[model samples]
Target: MKPVSRRTLDWIYSVLLLAVVLLSWGYVIYASTVAAQRQLRKEYPDKIFG
Candidate 1:
């Protein structure tokens, strides 16, 4: 059996970390936007803007 190269491993690790961070940030942003919208709706009743 052959051992994996360090450079390749490093690249894969970096890509995986980047994907995780991006997904987490995307979720956070989505949640924040939803919360903001909800707050706005609560603060302003009878307003059709969202």
Candidate 2:
């Protein structure tokens, strides 16, 4: 088997890093939204939408 070239390795590293950053960002937003909803529900248990 042949070793990967430096340029190919750089590209792969860049893509992986970008994917991690994007997924982390997306997860933060999703988690915050869910947390907010939970808080709202707790604060307003009698509300229908909550």
Candidate 3:
């Protein structure tokens, strides 16, 4: 079989790596938002729900 092309492999690797990094960052951002919301709820319990 012919050897894999470096350009193609590089592109694939970069895309997958970028996807992973973006997903990780997304999770971090979502978690922080959730934590902030919880904190706000605690701090303004009546104003928010009343």
Best by TM-score: 1
lDDT of 2: 0.93
Tell me the number of clashing residue pairs for each predicted model: 0, 0, 0
Q: Candidate 3 on 1-50: residue-level lDDT in tens?
A: 89999999999999999999999999999999989888889998876642
Task: Summarize candidate 2's per-residue lDDT along 1-50 as a digit string, tens digits.
Answer: 89999999999999999999999999999999999988888999987653
Q: Model 3 — TM-score against the truth?
A: 0.81
Compose the digit string of candidate 1's lDDT tens values, residues 1-50.
79999999999999999999999999999999999888888999778764
How well does candidate 3 score on lDDT at residue 40?
Answer: 87
Task: Give all candidates' CA lDDT scores.
Answer: 0.93, 0.93, 0.92
Model 3, residue pairs in steric clash = none
- Cα TM-score of candidate 1: 0.86
Instruction: Give the better candidate number (2 or 3) by TM-score.
Output: 2
Candidate 2's C-alpha runs over 4 A off are none
RMSD of each: 1.4, 1.5, 2.5
